[model samples]
Target: MSPQEKAGSGPAKAEICRAFSETADAYIIYGNMTDPDLYYASRFLASDSFTYILLASGHEILLVSEMEKNRALKESCVRDVRTTGEYDLRKKAAACRDASFGYAGVIEELLQKENVRKAAFPYNAPAFLYEGIRTGKAGIGVTLAKSPFLKARSIKSEEESACIEESMRGTEAAMEAAIDMIRKAGVRDGFLISPGTDRPLTGAEVLTEIDRVLTEHNDLGDETIVSCAEDSADPHGKTYGPLRAGQPIVIDIFPMNKRSRYFSDMTRTVLKGKASPELTKLYEAVRKAQEAGIAAARPGVTCADVHNRVCDVLEEAGYDTIRSGATVGFIHTTGHGVGLEIHEQPGVYDNDHVLVPGNVITIEPGLYYPGLGGIRIEDTVIITENGCRNYNKAEKVFEV
Candidate 1:
């Protein structure tokens, strides 16, 4: 289903309307489905460019090409669904001999029909369209503004939360399949081999399994990480060789649902063979730190506070962090919000955003050692009134 149909009511539309009223007489976002703001505002996903305008007069319009006219009308929740053809797009293009100028004329005509005195465009709106409106006949006062849809999306609607939760469940299935493969693999020559084949288990093989399982669950993985040994030392290491035995294998899977376009993030570090004393210690520290970060996440707590809570756990356990000016050890932010995009708002780091209910985030804490490998544990969660609700129910086991 389209985002509009799934939402029942328009998702984020109320917040978008409020921002539209506060920012300018009218707020405009121009782009394709790639522009999260445009997609959120229009509640329609189109590959080609489109326009969504919200007027202070409480009117909203979605303008699309004739090719998408019927789809937008059926899939989008906006009351005013218009087509460029209705504005004599071809005639205007022929008159100016420039499609860009014709598109600008169409936008100007739209504002004129509504008597829009001043309008606002997202900071990332099409430069040509923005410039065209600025250099138009009506002289509409256009100001660049932040994407209101992004801010609105930070707080997910119920349907959005459900979509993310479903994706996380899919992630659990994929993670289980990967970990099970590692657990059942036979160790030989200090490396893991497939259960039935002599071929050494490769990152490529595990990643393929991950995607296959995710696809079965209506989800898809992209650049899913399966780093081990020295490669695991890098936060986003990419390795595709034989899987080493008795070393930490970091499997970070972040996948999006095919239908909802919502994402889920999760990470797990597991040792295929036996873990050394130091390796166990490092893994335990990271686990404790992640738990501390999740515990600190709540409606009233600040993101910085939650991040610092994790740092405190790591530091107390004798680890250097970015806070201590260390280049290695516990680097990177504690976590970040997750939703339509992998990274959204209410960042769980130095950002001073106060956590609020409905804010979906991830608490991923890790420690990296260039030569000694690394360990990371992560989970997606939603801030609740009292504390937080973890969407991930995957078992956390360090040694397979």
Candidate 2:
């Protein structure tokens, strides 16, 4: 088995130690909060650089700057938080093999102190660190290995699920605000005007509405999708201008909680006025397909099974999907996992991964055409023992 497949959940010290011990004596990770693995293992976040180390004994160590030492101790699960000063980092921090050299030195120092002979690093390990180790210290054996953090994160703990559900509430609230605005919009000369302003409502305004509501809940909407008419044809399309009255207005919101740092995803399509007969059919097909996808997300089911269920529903409705090698129509994965990062592991697509109880994923099925515009409905859900628990409470209303 690959290292990832053999690993356990949640980046626990024992799991980390066992995950990388087959080929090396220790495992190390280096990065900032942007590195989800770093945050997951250390439970510590910082803007600047930091390092995490795990020994074969299941002991964990964290290295950070002095300014961050106290906060690391207060926030992180790692009890052995050390500042760079003790490793003689200040002197070399200036003119090392690059900025990473100084930190790499600190990492090497820790490995030596812990009596580590061989160490494995993530596949995406910092290049400068390799240079620092190769050029500065020559004793330790280092090699590239699977991080195992992704596999660990794939199965959400009860606490992680709670954080995701909390963030999902914010996403739902923001989606509610966006739909309400579109519903109350007044149509004039084939364009949607604001309810009170009498001015044409642009895609930008809808995005603002999403962000404004997310802010109230201490959540941040990063690149939320707000597209209208033909713009909606592209899944991640971002456009601006007055919304078409009878065409689809696709709004996909993904918000992350500021404090918890967990993400939630949801999407809804609405119309300011009335949808055409064909548009209505398109919307219903996507909605039904989403239902099928959700229904197939039970434990013991493979991800490919869930995706195929969605495809069957959409195809039975006379829509072309990737199954037929079609370029357009229904052209995306059924869903994906959500956690500290927006897109995590155990994708609900063609992959053959068996669904597990703790896997939190999204069921989003969409149909898009340049001429017909687009229609999509998405919901965040947790895969339960028998079935799935949906986090979204927003109704799937096609017309405003």
Candidate 3:
């Protein structure tokens, strides 16, 4: 069954309407494809481009192409799905020289039919689209409003949490497979050797294995990081080159489920052989800092408080942060919310946002030393009334 079939007047729609009521007469979205806001508003996933309008009267409408009208009617969250052809878009386009204006004319006609005088749009709407709507004959006024959909999406429902957990399960399985490969590899001349080949293993080879495992679970890894040695010092560095033993290797994997569209993020630093004394010290510090951040992630706690606690742990270890300079020590935010998008709201930084139940977030702490490398540990969790529940079960071992 489609998502819309299982959904029954969810709170997302009510929250969106409440936000819209405070801003404009109607909330309008126009796109040739699915925007994150539109996907959240309507639980219906559209493969093709379409327009969605939600009125203050609680009526929802979808204006789609004739090719998708039937599917929209059967699968969309909105009951009133109509074809743009019904609005004479093709006829209007034939008479008008400007295609953009012609499309806006059809939209304006629909708004007038609904008696909508002023409409609110997402803040990222294109300037051309805004100008087209404002210049239309309907005399409609447009305002670029911050997406109310994001506020509704910040808190997960039981069903949403379950979907995220399922995604995390697959992520952990893939992560375990990657770690297993590193554990069983033979060491030759301070480099990790491939199991089947005598040649040294490369970061691309490990990432290929990771993607293979994720594909088996119907997920895809985009820009997955598997950096080793010097490359690990740069947090967002892409994976490359041969793997070396007795050095830090950061494997940060974030994969998205093809079916649910939810994502899971997990990071673990491992060494194939014995870790150097300095590397060991860095790992321990990061692990303890991560624990402190997790401990602070409870309902009613502020995001700034959690970040500060993690910083305290790292600073106490005599490490520097971005506040000192860009080259070393603790950098980046503590963590961020994960869902349909890998990074979302309630960012665990020096922000004043309060943690609430149903808020799913990540607690990642890392320290980087120039020339020595970097060590990071991360886990996704859901905030509960008392504390947070970790979703990742992968063991945190510095040396494999």
Candidate 4:
């Protein structure tokens, strides 16, 4: 399913107004990114601009650079958009009679005239903008609020779910392509051999094949993970290693769809020959832990309870790997909400947040042994009234 075909309606102004009513008079959904690695933040917040327009919030401005004006208009929902360069900063500052007032005073004056009182901003708003409002001598007060707008964004509407489902499908297809390439390359004695030849595949070659397969879909931002052997010990290892017979290969791929911006994350452990007894046991334990964590997800379970359940299962199976603590079966949180953002709210940790219907979170539980490698089984799931629905379609078995 393409993003165009699955794209659905988003939250209305009235809905957002209700969500942040007590938090602020108006929500300033700002996207301040120093890099363009993740392009979805601005688009996700644009939904708020559309809601504000419908609510008639006097004016909702999306300030961007001159270069971003055209792209912003095409992608954003706000009509009253402006570029920072268009305004004369010196003139605007001079307009304020109080020399000490500065640009903050000028902006406060404009906002007060519009009858705006309090404003809420995104979690990552710039320090200058925040300090300006905090120090501004305006009689109107500006209170900072960490409104979990993304939390509300996590629970996908039917249309949003479909968009993510399609992205996940694309991700799975790419993973299949990478795995097939690795297997058919005829790896031997820790060296990958090219098809119909004895030439060895470098660590770089495996990554190139993975990147080529994923980029064919276009919406993907970067190459997916293709960790092998010892590198797999680190949850987020960056370096790649050559694949060889009997060595465990962990191929984790996550890519966003070009049109919808919704992404899919999936991991599968592979091998060209039989896995060691210890490695196989670790794999079974992690798979069981992941399944147990998923079974604990429901409408009323607390995040801590779900996490403790996985911890208990892993400990009982004697697969717990604790470093600093007395025992550490799983070091990280059980999972987190997934949607517009790769990592969202409703975190499955030892926190106190209650699970609710419509919540979509990952249930990834694993064990890692230094020098021995690690195994983790992760899947995205939607919480239902009765249970939950798993979105991943890949099999979990590890075989040559």
Index of the highest-lDDT prediction: 1
- Candidate 2, which ten residues in sequence have the lowest lDDT sum? 1-10
The segments of candidate 3 whose C-alpha lies over 4 angstroms from its true place after superposition are: 1-11, 32-34, 323-327
| Candidate closer to the true structure by TM-score (higher is better), 2 or 4 | 2
- Candidates sorted by lDDT, best first: 1, 2, 3, 4
Worst lDDT run of 10 residues, candidate 1, spans 2-11
Of 1 and 4, the candidate ranking higher by TM-score: 1
Better of 2 and 4 by lDDT: 2
Residue-by-residue lDDT tens digits, candidate 3, 1-400: 3444323365666777888777688888876433666766555666666788889877888888888877777767778888878888878777777666677778889988999988888877766667878988779998988877776677877777877888888788888988888888889999999887898888888899999989998888899999899889988875578899898899999998877778889999999988888999999999999999998999998999999899899989989865455457998999999887899987998889999998989999899877999999999999987898999988999999
Clashing pairs in model 4? 190-244, 322-328
Candidate 3: residue 320 lDDT (0-100):
84
Clashing pairs in 1: none
Name the TM-score of candidate 3: 0.95
Deviation from truth (RMSD, Å), model 1: 2.1
- Give the local distance difference test score of model 2: 0.84
Better of 3 and 4 by lDDT: 3
Task: Give the per-residue lDDT of model 1 (tens digit) for 1-400.
Answer: 4456432244455666677676578998788877766666667998888888888766788999989888888888786899999899898889889898889889999998899988898777777788888999998888988776666778876778888988988999999999999999999999999889988999889999999999999998998999989999999997799999999999999998878788999999999878999999999999999988988888988888998999999999999887878889898998888988898887788878988888999999999999899899999999877999999988899999
Looking at model 2, residue 70 earns an lDDT score of: 93
